[model samples]
Every structure is written in C-alpha cells, then in structure tokens.
Target: MTEAQRQIFVFMIYALIMVNFSGSSHGGAVSSEEEADRITSLPGQPKVYFQQFSGYVTVNKAVGRALFYWLTESAHSPLSKPLVVWLNGGPGCSSVAYGASEEIGPFRINKTASGLYLNKFSWNTEANLLFLETPAGVGFSYSNRSSDLFDTGDRRTAKESLEFLIQWLDRFPRYKGREVYLTGESYAGHYVPQLANEIMAYNANSKHRIALKGIMVGNAVTDNYYDNLGTVTYWWSHAMISDKTYRQLINTCDFKRQKESDECESLYSYAMDQEFGNIDQYNIYAPPCNNSDGSTFTRRNMRLPHRSHRIFRQISGYDPCTEKYAETYYNRPDVQKALHANKTRIPYKWTACSEVLNRNWNDTDVSILPIYRKMIAGGLRVWVFSGDVDSVVPVTATRYSLAQLKLTTKIPWYPWYVKKQVGGWTEVYEGLTFATVRGAGHEVPLFKPRAALMLFKSFLRGQPLPKS
Candidate 1:
C-alpha cells in the first residue's frame, strides 16, 4: 500500500481504539475515569445484575481532602432512575458502613464478613443510590491536614459536601440536571437541610444548577429545646425511666442551652446509666448486638460520653452483629483494593463512626426548623419521618419539633398500609409531610425494610403514602 493509504488506515484504527477506551468495558456510556472507578465485583459479594462504582472525589485541593462515595445504580432501568443521595449522620458516621451496607443499599455484609447477601427491600430498586462519606475525617474520606478533623463543624462540612457534589457530577456528567433527593437519618437531619440550603445557594449563582427536588430525614435531630423535652417525655411514656427521674431530667436539664450544665449532665448520666441500662438506645425494643460490650455510638449519646463509650453498634431483623461484620469487611486489604478506597493509606482503622470528629464537631444549629420553613416555602418536597421505637431521636421529639412549624394540615393523620398491614402512620401538611414507621428504630430501613422502601418509593414519586 502507498504511504498515504497506510496513514489513513492507521488513523481509522486509532479512532476505533479511542471509542473502545472511552466507553465502559461492559459497553455502557461511561468516561474512562468512571470505568476505572467501577467495581467488577466486591470481595465475596453476591452476584448482582447492577453496576457499582466507588472511589474518592477531591473536595479541597489545598488540604488534600477527598470524600469517598459508592454509587449503586438501580437493578432495573438504571439510566431512567432518579438519583438519591443517602447520608448517615453521627455528625461523623460513615454512610458506607451504615447506609450503604446496612440500611438502603442492595447488599448486607454477612455476620462472618465472609460474604454478602442481597437485601430484598433495598431502595436502589427505585432509584440510583449514592452513599457518601462526607467532610474530611470520616471513613475513607480524609485530609492531609489533621487539623481539619479537629476544626470540623456544620458550616465547613456543608461547604465541602457541596464541593464534592459539584465535582462528582462533573466526573459523572450523565447525572447533571437529573432529579435528586437528599435523604438521611439522625444528625443528618442537620446535614440534609444544611446541604439543601447550600445547594439552593449554589443554584442561584451557577448556570448548571443541581436539580434538588426534595429531602427526607428520619429520626433526625431538629430543635434542641423541643428534642430534649420530647426525649424526656418519650422516656417517661415508654416506661424507659421512672417518674421521679423524668421530673429531674425535665427540671435540671437546661434544654434551651447548647451545652448541658453540670447538673443537667449529671441528671442525664443518672437516667441513662442507672435507669436505662444496657439497652440499645437506637432501638428501644431491639436486642443489642451480641458482640457489644454495652457502648453505643449515636449523636445523642455523643454528649453523654460516659454512657456512649464506643462505636459500631448494630440491630434489627437481621443479625445484630452486622456493624462488626462491616468493620471487618471494609478494613480487609482486598476489600479496600476492590473499592478503590484508602488510597492515601491514612493511619486509622475504619470504624462505623469517627470518635475524633464526633467529639470535635464544632458548630451545630440548635434548630433545623428554619431551613425546613425555607425549603417548604421554596416548594421543595419536605418529609420528616420517625421510627417510633427509636429512643435517641424518638417519634415524640420529631412531633414536637414539627408542631412548632404550625403548617396547615393538607391531609389528616392516617394509617398507611404496606402488604395489607399497618406499616406506619402519616400526616401531610400544607408544605410538609410527617410520618412514623411502626416498630422501626433509629435506622428506619434496618428495622423496617419493607416500610422504609415503600416510604422511599412514595417520596420519589411525590405521592402520599398508600392510604389503603
């Protein structure tokens, strides 16, 4: 062949190679970077039909801070599904350990950490699930600047998370302008609303706005005064504590203050240690994880450090040792390699919650109600749900906090059904909806998987909970 002909043939071959390299190995539309992040399969994970991607997204270049994320696309019609961002809050919890592994994502790590099993009620059936380990100190997400861990607070966390999302979307530009919902539990009540507020602010300035449609938080921490009062009431009403202890908790504990007084601290310690002994505070009725030595990791328990001595507690329909399983599984060298995590090899074991960051979380808004009011008025779908059996951030606390909103009732309180059973009760107000999952714990999905999945489906469709 002539030189000209040979050159033309070489160009054609290069173009073909480029096409093959740019597209996903599995023939889906994905960037080379995305393909690199894709998990062919996790260690001992059950054979799954859907695709999974996980890795880090750098949020702050100056500090070398990066956040880890796991994307579990829907098992069916993934491209057509909307995106749901799930955050599990300890103000320092790893969403991967709690949300992705236990609550909403498709897989549940076996007790032995030997293999994985499919969760029949995983939320990914209805939406693309993205679990993020936010800020700089939690899970595999880390920072070169150790001070970042100590200086962590609501403001910085929100800012960094917004940065993470913006950069993450750029990395997976396919999701730009897609319907997005922010959902979480516990302290995520704070993280969800704060992040939503930031997203709104970002949209106002940027041309490529995030399509943030709604937010759903469960057993969340809302108003401080109301939460404190309501928690005491719940303890008394549920018979968790005696009448005399309840009165002392009510009178001595300064609910209005951000920091508890010495007397208040003593009273709380008394109630927890003396009265409520060795119980799973996250789930009032559920058995504690068999491996647990009585310490629980939670936001409410964060304050009372005496009672909350450790991290990685577990509960629910499945074996109670799941957290231990996750701890063992994620820390495995092979598991980390498969996930593309711990690339920096930071010097710390992977715990479900970060003790350092949880203790040092600097600023917290006493009330998230203002953000709720703003989002509600902004025409965003806002839903606050509670697990009735959770004592930490109980149903009563959620009720009291929401009652302060004074939203007009759009739908009266009613029982919502799932599989012809009374799954939960729900009330739709003018701008918000409040629901309680019957017998669910702090981690709603872990305790009531069917009901939580149904709740999620209804939320995504912007439909009311099934009345029948």
Candidate 2:
C-alpha cells in the first residue's frame, strides 16, 4: 500500500475509534406513564431503572456514513465508574437482546410476554453500562456500504469497538479518565478481549491519556480448537450423547488432524460428518423455539421446549404461565411492537437466533487471541459466564475454550451462592473468572435474571460473585 494510503487507513481507523461515542439525545422516543415517568426512562424496554444516572451517547448518524448510532449510559456519580462495553454473541445477534433485556440491565422482558419487568439487581448499578449493536449489520446500527462486511474478523471488530469507546469518551468527557472494562459473552468472547487489547495499545501510543482497566466475557467463543471438542464433551457428560457416539467422535474429531487437512477438500467434510451426527448440541435444552429450518436438524440456536428446528415449530412450553403469556402476547399487536426484534416483524414469532451471516466467512483468530492475552496479562479483570444448559455455544463449549487458555487458576472452583443458596459455579484463573448459571439456558438473563445480575455486578467491582 502507498504511504498516503496507509496514512489514510490509520486516519480512518482513528476516526472509527472515536465515532460511536456521542452524548445525550432527546429522550422522548421512550414515552412513559405520567407517574411512571418519575421512575422509568425507556418504555418499550422495561425501564428497569439503575441507581446510577443515565444518558445516551451517539456515534455518526446512519444517514450517510457507515458509522451509525451508538448508545451509552453511565452511573451518575462524581466518582468515576468502571465502564463495560457489552456485546451479545450472535454472529448477528443484538447486544440489546441479551445484555440489556435479559441479563444485568435494570429491565427485562416478561417471560415470553410482551411487556417489561423490573430486575431488582442490575449490573449498571455498580458500573457504567454500555451496550452496542456492533458491526452495523446487527441492530438499529447500520452501515451504508455493504462492503463493510469485508471487515468481519476479530482484529477489525475489536479495533472499531475500541474506537467507539474513545469516541464515546470524547463525547462523555466526564468518563475520559475512568477505568474502562470490556465485557460480553458467547461470540463476544472474541469481541471483548480483542477490543480491550486495542484500547490498551492505543492508550500507550496516543499522546492523550486513556484509562483502560479490564475485560470480562461470559460464555465467549474464545478458542476455536478446543471449543468444538469441549462442546462434544459437554454433551457426552450430560448424557446427551451415547458412549459409542462419544468414542467415535473422540477417535476422529481432532483439531490438529483437521488443521493438517488445509488443502484437502474432504478434511472439513470428514470433521463435520463426525460432528453433526453426534448428539445435537441443542440437545442440552429443548428447542427454545423452532429451528427456522426443518425438523431433521435440532435448532441451531438456543433450544426451546417443544418445537423442532426443521419445521420452525412453536414448542408447547411446559411453564403454564409462560405458555399462556406466549399465547396471549403472540396475538397482541402492542406486545409485538414492544419486543421489536430482528428476523420477525410486528407479528413477533418466537424463534431461535437464525443463521444470519454467510456460512463460509473469515475469522481473525490469530490476531485476536494475542489481544485477549494482552488484556489478561495486563491485569484487566476478565469474566466468562454461561448457562450450562444452552446448547448453542453450550457452556461446555465455553469451558473448552477457556481450558485452551492455560491461565493458572487464581480462584478455586466453588458454587456461586445467590440469595443464601448455591446458585451456580464460579472459578478464576489469574484475573479471568468463569461462572455457570445452573438451570439457565441460552439467554442467561431471561432464564436466570438474578444470577446474571450478580454476575454482571461482580464484574463491575472487579470482584468475585458474592457468595449467596
């Protein structure tokens, strides 16, 4: 590349770094009841109020440029708060879907119901919460150029996310010197660390000062090599796979062996054949909704209760209340308007995260891992949590990803207690911690709101989950 071109590239990257951070906007979009206005701010989304103060941060507008909208909220205390930029993992999922709606956010959507519910515990109470619909293609955030998809990879994604932070800080100048943390789960395992590392690097190079602290990932897709293996192991351990099937996969499904087949066309075919036939990963939980495909396949997304993925069938939920809510809400136009989800339109159809990206695409794993390691080594508090029950990117898969890290255990394994009772499991290696939500499935916040909130709160404080 020419020198001018390289400089341009760097300049654009620098702009990207600072683009998504904008300050407060007109708050009227989310209306409220006359009395509720005293409490809630956002309406469609259950305005679960955090104790902290709130505001909006904007990026470049979507009208022309690739950089679209950015949203930010901070704890309104004079003392700076640790900032966590939260991303949800769907290769195409919305961060607001899980991080805001279900997990640590102050608000939650009612169980299969259209309306919002209050979460007594919200992660934002402890730290400033930042949620994003990154990569433009995901949520309200959009890119005018389709070619932007070419930027898909660990490195670029992280770089832009970091830039978003710098820009966010620039707008909310008050947070300029605050300790910043990056946290997310699922595919974000790759996103959070990569971005956190870039911020660390940027702070070092820039004449201007930037304070970056730590990172946390819950059920992130960290390591590719062992992730698949760990997933299979989880299925086998949970009795989802039979012994013969496990042994067969164990004998053939090897990452090293698969890597050697780089030039061989049949290599991936053989590995996949060995993989897909084993117990369905989604077998961990029943299909959450239909697969959006045919019945022949277990839903590729989170499993629901009764539906098959193939037919896109709606499962007869076992929870009578949830079932009634689902039935009633599905028929209600106002409720459908509230969820405002992806894929399905006003008539909200309950579905798992569908195949939203190109099948054969790019991965910047090599570049991304170094950044993750840097964040970890730099004493950035990192946390990875997951519901053991999620079949898609199962908790076992997360465990397998972490096992590849080889980080020494800083905190020994123990049941994370919640409400004076053991809620689930937690462990720490060096500064990175991992936790499991016992009965919770794919969406931890929706299924295990309290535990998820506790997990988020602990991350904000850079402490372990409080023992119940």
- Taking the tens digit of each residue's C-alpha lDDT, what string does model 2 give over 216-305? 676566555566567657757776556767676666555433142332324333433554443323223544333236344333333111
lDDT of 1 by residue, 1-468 (tens): 996666456556644644664564433466677879999899898766677899999888987999999999887666678999998888788999999998998999987898899999999999999999987889899999999899888898899899999988877876887899999999898899999999999998999899999999999989888887888899999998999999887877778887777877777778777888777777878876553565543322354211122322334445566777888999999999999999989999987778789888788887889999999988899999999998888899899999999999989999999999999999999989899999998899998999999999998888999999
Query: Which residue ranges in model 2 land beyond 4 Å of their true spot?
Result: 1-80, 110-115, 256-283, 290-360, 366-369
Clashes of 1: 0
Residue runs of model 1 more than 4 Å from their true location after superposition: 1-29, 292-301, 304-317
Worst 10-residue lDDT window, candidate 2: 303-312
Scored by lDDT, the top model is 1
Query: lDDT for every model?
Result: 0.85, 0.54
Root-mean-square deviation of every model? 7.6, 12.1
**Top of the candidates by TM-score:** 1
What is the Cα-based TM-score of model 2? 0.69
lDDT at position 269, candidate 2: 38
